[model samples]
Target chain A: MAKILVVDDSNFQRNQILRAIKDDGYEIFTAENGKIGFDLFEEHSPDCILTDLNMPELDGLGLLKLIREKNTDVPVIVLSSDTQELTAEKCKNLGATDFMNKPFKKDQLKAVLEKVFQ
Target chain B: MILTPDQEDAIKEFINIGAGHAAGALSELTESHVKLSIPAIKVVKLADLEKEDDSFTKEISSSVRINFKGFTDGTAALVFPPASALKLVSLVSDEEFGTPDMDSVQAGILTEIGNIILNHILGAIGNIFQQHLEYNVANYVEGEIIKLIEPDDSTPDLVIMIIDTQFNLKDLEITGDVVIFFKLGSLTKFVEAVENVLS
Candidate 1:
């Protein structure tokens, strides 16, 4: 089973995303902030990571930027409430696999992850 | 969305855009330069759930609510005391409607004001994130502040932003509470966009 890391300061969001992808048989691990997210990433070595852009301590971008230094192969999908071209472009430049807008449907999350995994 | 310094500043600026837009609309409406600014933005829990006798929730205030959509979708309201609401009605209309309670006509005026304020804010927010948003017709509801905004499926660990804005009618203060109820799930994305601008 593929393991996925979910990082978000919002518990509600974390649960929503996790629930959307949980039934896929992927082991989902969650962190409240970037620092913990990175620590878990190092330990769990998730196949893919889904992170929220804004968080306390360290944010999703901050984590992605740091992770790129050590491991550029790990696929990271960035989720944000607002969709700004500049931000999405920057995330892509930082080696992000994809960028998604929030209030994502279950099918949307599943389809993206399926594509990434394939 | 935990009130980090960066997130806090971003939220304040976000609200500032909405406030500025609302003020602009009011200026155009009244032909007077209305001064509207948000002094503080704080994440607050629902008063009814937090305290039994919350002074903030004690007042018999009237509210005009609009459905805020795009990014973080939910309800946004401009809540004020009944007298203040009446005064606002008086400023906008040519009729003498100085009643303690908001009559149907006064309520209609309040609804229009609420729609104006919300549309301005929603437009500013939607434009900021490069998204288009549409809000439903503004609804006027009178009662406790918490009850007015609280959703049917109560959020447990719920926290909302209290945008304190001072609406001025030429040196006179129009005391109103700009309360927004968000589907917190979507705020994660909203904050994400703010961080994008910051980064």
Candidate 2:
């Protein structure tokens, strides 16, 4: 079982997130969008998920809600370019673990994952 | 809407800055020197834009679009030419060209690239303007290009269309768009920021 599930519509971002977390020795599974992400989530039940807010089909928020409905405890961190406080608040209210602005630092990703998985 | 002289200059300057940032980010990611030229900015009636040679349609056969509301109400999109998109996937994946599936992988790469480029541009705008903006969910579609442009109910406003021409060190051309919807009032502020930064 992978410890992390990196979900986004972008290969570059998925790769960047995967590269950042690979050193933690956690198996990583990736999905292109929310629909596939949810399917993978059900199958692998990863400890944490890093997702992009803007994605085709089911978006990050929709995926977050779906994942919460199935297993509310899994950490779902939103990664998006939209930095409005309202978006962050909405994600938090919907049971997201945290929100990280896009183009995040390497240490920030590790720190957030540690906080959630610890 | 015809922009004042100051607004035109500001708009150009704003795009120039945004393009510069995008170039830096692409260079870092690709590890190849990348150069981006200032996109020719234009403000034409929607009807006029639709009738112009249909180059955008030919360039992007399929796309996924997302409309961002708040601060600015405009549509942003991710458009991919089939062959060029496939080339990008091959470049990023280091996979041998052996009939790899195109649909899912192509969608994945384009969506990610669009996400990065759009985010970088929007983030730069937010930084310069000192306002926070939020993005809506991305909607995927594969069909005629005309379907991408629907009438916005948010009162007709200025549409800022930026055509990104990316060139790697070897002159590999990766083309994309950064379209922003601007409300009239905020459009003034945006223009001011452009002028301030440029002048």
Candidate 3:
């Protein structure tokens, strides 16, 4: 089973993401902020990481920077409502495997995960 | 109106970029072509919101409101009148319109839409300022315009910036307003940040 870590500050968003991927058979772990998310990442070494861009304590960019410094192979998909080309470019420069905008469709998310694991 | 022409121009450009992204998000989510009209920016005292425009005072609307702090503090919302709100939810969701069960579904769908739209705009501001912002969870509310923008503890004398932009979607042209209010002292901080970016 693939382990995936999902990090976001909003409970509603976290629940929505959980509901979307729960039936896919991946072992899912969640955290409310990037700090907890990194802690989980270190402990479980999730196969994939999905995170929101704006968050308290540690934002997605900070988490991505932290993750990239230590591990290079794990796929980190950065999600945000900010769909600016510059935002995506920054994530790519920081070594994000992919960037997905928030309020994403369930099928779209699942397909991205499938692509990542494949 | 308090802003100099250069500052106003800069702010408009910033907001336009944000609205363009928001339009794209709305278009993809609704499977409709969304077009954004130019934004009209105004600074108004909290107590004078009703005097500023009929749209802000008389219209009964459904809105998803998000509050944020950091870099600046304020509220942002996606507001639609009742008919437009119903039309939008009907276009996007599987639920039949006017049904009893739709009340909850409408709130859910709109809240998510608001979350996406507001975040993109605020995210643009954050990026332009190179600062981090913390946002509260998005909330769905229904009321007249003043009720939509006023926080519980807002001082009546404080001034705010109101940016009103209209989004026209598909052939139906379901109109919605993207309203952002920068709280009292935050408007100055916001404009200063914009000027800093421009400089």
Give the per-residue lDDT of model 2 (tens digit) for B1-199: 6677677666666666666776665555556677877556665444455555535644445565666554555666656555555666566555645663366765665555555656566656666666666666555555555566555433434454545444453367765445454545555555656556666
For candidate 3, state the interface root-mean-square deviation in angstroms to 1 decimal: 4.4
Chain A TM-score vs. truth, each candidate: 0.96, 0.95, 0.97
Report model 2's interface C-alpha RMSD after superposition on the true interface residues. 3.6
Instruction: Indicate the residue-level lDDT of B181 in model 2.
Output: 46
lDDT of 3: 0.79
Alpha-carbon shift of residue B157 in model 3 (angstroms):
2.0
Q: Of the true interface contacts, what fraction does each candidate have?
A: 0.00, 0.42, 0.28
In terms of lDDT, model 2 sits at 0.66
**Which parts of model 1 are misplaced by more than 4 Å?**
A1-118, B47-56
Q: What is the C-alpha lDDT of each candidate?
A: 0.74, 0.66, 0.79
Q: Which scores higher on lDDT, 1 or 2? A: 1
Worst 10 residues of 3 chain B by lDDT: B93-102
Clashes by residue pair, model 2: A10-B112, B74-B181
Q: Which residue pairs does candidate 1 place in steric collision?
A: A80-B189, A81-B189, A81-B190
- In angstroms, give how far residue B183 of model 2 lies from its true place: 7.6
Off by over 4 Å in 2: A1-16, A27-51, A55-78, A82-118, B50-54, B57-64, B78-81, B96-102, B139-144, B151-164, B180-199
